[model samples]
Target: MNLLLVEDDLDLGNGVRIALANQGMDVVWVRRLDDALRTLDGGTFDMVLLDLGLPDGDGLDLLFRLRRDRQILPVLVLSARDALNDRLRSLDDGADDYLVKPFALAELLSRVRALARRSYGFNDETIRMRGLALHEPTRGVIVDGEPVELSRCEFDLLALLLKRTGRVVTRRVMEEQVLPGGQANGSNSLEVHISNLRKKIGQGYIRTVRGIGYVIDVQSLARSTQK
Candidate 1:
């Protein structure tokens, strides 16, 4: 998962980023709401871990703007405010979930996973399509009942593709969500990764849509092969 973390607390922010990274998540940390907005505008994130108290302005301001713009990205507010009104207002103002400060990282990760699943129209940790199983909790993939060993990047890339199953995932979207921000490799690099990924999984799993991007259409491909 790719996440945007907006927090000004140095210790807490760094700790959370490290923990999330260790769990196979790509995270971008920004201290202020301005930076958060800038990052949000530029990159695609699976979710946002937002801190209401920010240096430049309140994080709620960002949330409000996102809602006003009709952005449906999942946001989980992390703040020190524990008041009932605060919780109610946050939910009313488009926060998908809320977590108070001094919370366990484990619980936060659970919530993050929950929100991510919801975004993908799934209620479970594992997403399955056409005999391919993506276990989000372990970042594991299984094909034809066999476990497939994948690099972190490969796993993330496959997860993204699986989430969009039959659709053509644009190169720009892949770069933002799969690769590190500002470190998206050249076209040849992504092609090489895709090549290796096909070798591990199956060459029939992915299709390169020249001039557009890549796609995975297992059912469609199966039908075509049968014909």
Candidate 2:
């Protein structure tokens, strides 16, 4: 998932970014609310982690502005404020969830996954299509009752495809989700990841639409012929 983290503390931001990246999330850290707002205005993000004690302004004001502008992106407040009133205020101001500082990374990840699933209209962590299964929190993919090992990027690629199963995802669309900032990368990186993913899940799992992009047969790929 693509995430924007707005935290003023450099060390905390770096640590959280690294940890989330290790968990297969593309996280962009912005130290100030203005930078965060600018990034939000520029691109789409799956979620936002806003620290209330920002250097420039209160994070609640940013949250309020996002709501005022009718942005539906989920925001989770991460701050040291643990008082009941503070949590209530944050939620009332449009924060989806609140995490206190010195929090466990695992808990944060779990909450993030929950919010992500909620955003996708899924109440569960496991996503199933045909005979394929993906456990998002654990980053596990299983096909035909056997476990499949996938690299971080491969898993992310597969997750993106599965999320939109049955839809033809164009190269540009996939690149936007898979590549950070939608930046250009080494030639054929998408193709390489797709190729490797197909090898693990079987070639028939992802279909290449000539001169267009790829599609996953959400209902019947498991029964199709593999190249």
Candidate 3:
């Protein structure tokens, strides 16, 4: 999952970003609300990890704007305010979940996964499609009942695409989410990873969309093969 982290505290932001990325999730960290808004304007993130206090303004304003604009992306508020009214107001403003400050990273991760599942309409950690079984908790991939080891990038890429199966995923989105520094770094790492994934999981699963991107349209591939 690609996450946009809106926080001002340098230490906490880094810690959260590193922890989330270590768990095979993509993250982009910004310290100010304006930066967060700009990032949101152009980015295709799956969710937002919003801090209630920001350097420029309150994070509640961002949440209010999102709800006002009808952006339904899942948001989990991370705040130091433990007052019942504060939490209630945030939820009422449209946050999917809330996490108080100084919480355990493990618990935060769990909440993130829960929100991800809820927003993506996934009922469990393991996403089963076609013959592939991707177990998120264990970071395990089983193809046709056989375990297939994958690097972190490959695993993240596959999970992102699989979650959106039968739909075209833009190349820009994939590169930013999976590649380093939200870029290709002038290298063909995106293609290389995809090629390696294809070799390991078997072909005909991912198809190049020509000038646009790639897709995992099982039905279309099946139909073309039967022709």
Candidate 4:
């Protein structure tokens, strides 16, 4: 999942970014409300982890602006304001879920999954295509009723390709979305991950698009499993 994290505190933001990245989420972190808004304007995200207090402006105003402009993505408010009214106000304004500060990361993850199921409608957090099933919460992969062990990068790569079944995912998009950072391409790391992922998932999936990119053909997926 692509997540936008809007936070000002350096320590907390770094910690959260690392934790989210460990879970195979593509996260973009910004400290100020203006930066957050600019990121939102330019990028597409599945969820927003928003801090109610920002350096440039109130995070509530940003939430309001998102709603006023009709951008209907899930927003989970992470605030130190623990009052009932604060929670109520956040929900009323457009936040999908609220978490008071100093909370557990496990709880945050749970809420994130719940919001994902709510927003995207993968009720069980499992995205299935062909003979493969990718479970989000456990990061488990199963092929033809057999479990497939995969490295973190391989699992993330498969999830991206599986989520976009039948659609081409370009190399640039994969690097920007799936790679750890700029230096991740030290020596064709993305291709290595894709090759490993394809091997684990088996044949007849993840076809290369010449010089363009890669895609998992949905029609071929059905045929592969059926045969």
- Which segments of candidate 1 are over 4 A away from where they belong? 122-125, 128-170, 175-227
lDDT, residue 183, candidate 4? 29
Best-matching candidate per TM-score: 1
Task: State, as a TM-score between 0 and 1, how close model 3 is to the true structure.
Answer: 0.61
- What tens-digit string does per-residue lDDT give for candidate 2 at 124-143? 57877767888989999899
For candidate 3, write residues 39-146 as lDDT tens digits. 988767778999998878999999999899876778999999999999999999999999999899999999998886766545457876677888888989998899
Clashes of each: 0, 0, 0, 0
Query: Clashing pairs in model 2?
Result: none
lDDT of 2 at 186: 52
TM-score for all models, in order of appearance: 0.63, 0.58, 0.61, 0.59
For model 3, the stretches where C-alpha displacement exceeds 4 angstroms are 123-125, 128-227
Model number with the top lDDT: 3
RMSD of each: 6.6, 7.9, 6.7, 7.6
The deviation in Å at residue 170 for candidate 3 is 5.8
Tens digit of per-residue lDDT, candidate 1, span 160-210: 887665556778787766775624545466776777887788756778888
Error of 1 at 2 (Å): 0.1
